[model samples]
Target: MPTVTWSRLNEDRRAAVVAAAEAEFAAHGFSQGSLNVIARRAGVAKGSLFQYFADKRDLYAHITDVGSQRVRCYMEDQIRVLDPTRPFFAFLTDLLDVWVAYFAEHPRERSLHAAASFEVDTDTRVSVRAVIHRHYLEVLRPLVRDARGRGDLRPDADTDALLSLLLMILPHLALAPYVRGMDPVLGLDELSPDQPALVVRRYVAVLAAAFAPQPLTTATPGGAQSHG
Candidate 1:
């Protein structure tokens, strides 16, 4: 939490501090992030940063909250518009498209997020895990239940496991090429407009085959007709 002094600062000053902190933390994660650099960037003396935030940890929490809130807003918009009636693959694929769009639009935040994943403090890591877990429980779990009610999933499918698998793989797939130099999921790190999406769809198709229930077949009084 920011101190009263931080709250009392004019909007421009507050923005400067946060923007500078965000850039520094994004570049080097918490351990390596430099408060001196942030102060320099924000045009404030080193002593002044303490008036706003108690320490680096406090400032980091604020920056992370800002980032998570923005991401949550994007997710809220997407989840509201998703149709449960669509096949799981179709729906998940669309959701991935939205995710890719989110990253693309907020490219400045990419290193911020990657730093959180690879080199953050224990507290930050725990909080991020909680946030992601909550997002899936609140937004994604319902989608799986809706699909089950509509018979899109197997009668005995473990909704928890299915959602977990998705939560694990989707983000990795999105970051594969960048995170792993020789990733099995290729083209994601390439700067092409379409390559990332193509990678998502291609892998999603393979995973969906395992998760999708049998295709529905319509039946007349005399016999069954496949629904193409």
Candidate 2:
């Protein structure tokens, strides 16, 4: 958490400090991130950083918190314009497109998120992971409920389990292009402009198949009727 002195700083100064910290941690993970470099980049004295935060860990935590908020805000903005009446799979494809756009444009924030997700300290990692998971679930729960209600998804499906699979795979879809070795088959080095769209479409196809409504069959004189 930041001190009152941090609040007293001008908005531009605060923004500079946050930007510097994000860049530093994005370039080097928490363990190797340098306060001196951050101070130099932000044009503030190293001691002034201590006045703003208690320690390196505190600053790191605050920066990650800021990044998470930015991610949520970006998603909220996308949600406002997206069509709510679209079918579940169509809506989901658009939702994933938003993820790809956000991560692609904000590489620094993505790196900060990755750092927190893979934090070395067990306590920090768990705490950050909880917040990330909560945000993801909050965004997804409604979509899953709506899909089930609309009979686009199986009513018997476990919401939590379905969300867990989405949490595991969807976010990584955005990273495939940016991260080295993450897209071995896609060969992002020479990727076409439409390659990302192709990736998302294929992934959504698999999800649609996996989550399709279960068939309801009734007995007939000579056959079973499928009400799938």
Candidate 3:
């Protein structure tokens, strides 16, 4: 067999390392995973891991970056195919569809992310956590702002508040299956990848209705005392 040089390793090996690392992290979380085991699983030496990454945190960050980029690309691709004139709820539905696809296609990455969320390392946790948090904010902030500009959203709607609600709601919906009996009606865990889109679509419709701009109606003369 020809010798494998430091730079001669194919992309397959690199992908293997990432995949193995994701599984390791998902199984053990950040603080508990063993680099030695990871290296062995990746068919590399413990020292070779350092050749590819400075440390465990670096590897974890790289995983986060890769996963985030994949999700961003999926969202962008979906958005590009959408009609810009469509209502904002259509865009939200597309967004959820992309997420459902991602979770189904990359379940291990999702598990890794779920594990990372509870990490105890202040610095590493905060850094990686920020990447995921910022990803959602970066996408939603502009979308919400544009919707408001187009009169698709309520005039008094708080973009930040809406972003926060979406950030909280999407993940909960996405991860409900993994949450252990939290959503019996959804039973996300039991549903296959093909099934999530429909469930998520209905969920987004409810949110869209709640956030949709409503026509102002004149108050009744004897309407209950207004707070403002």
Q: What's the TM-score of each model vs. the native?
A: 0.74, 0.82, 0.74
Query: Candidate 1 has which clashing residue pairs, if any?
Result: none
lDDT of 2 by residue, 1-228 (tens): 789999999999999999998898888876678889999999999999999998776787788778878898888778767865578888878888878878889888778777765578776666556667777788778878888888888777676777888988765765667777666775554567777777888888887777876567777777857564
Candidate 1 local lDDT, 31-75, one digit each (tens): 678989999999999999888878766777677777767777877
Q: Ten-residue segment with the worst summed lDDT in candidate 1?
A: 173-182
Of 1 and 3, the candidate ahead on lDDT is: 1
Regions of candidate 3 where Cα sits further than 4 Å from its true position: 1-13, 118-123, 184-210, 218-228
* Cα RMSD to the true fold for all candidates: 4.2, 2.8, 5.7
lDDT of 3 by residue, 102-122 (tens): 665677766766766767778
Cα error, candidate 1, residue 107 (Å): 1.5
Model 2's C-alpha root-mean-square deviation from the true structure amounts to 2.8
After TM-score superposition, the amount by which residue 191's alpha carbon in candidate 2 deviates from its true location, in angstroms, is 3.4
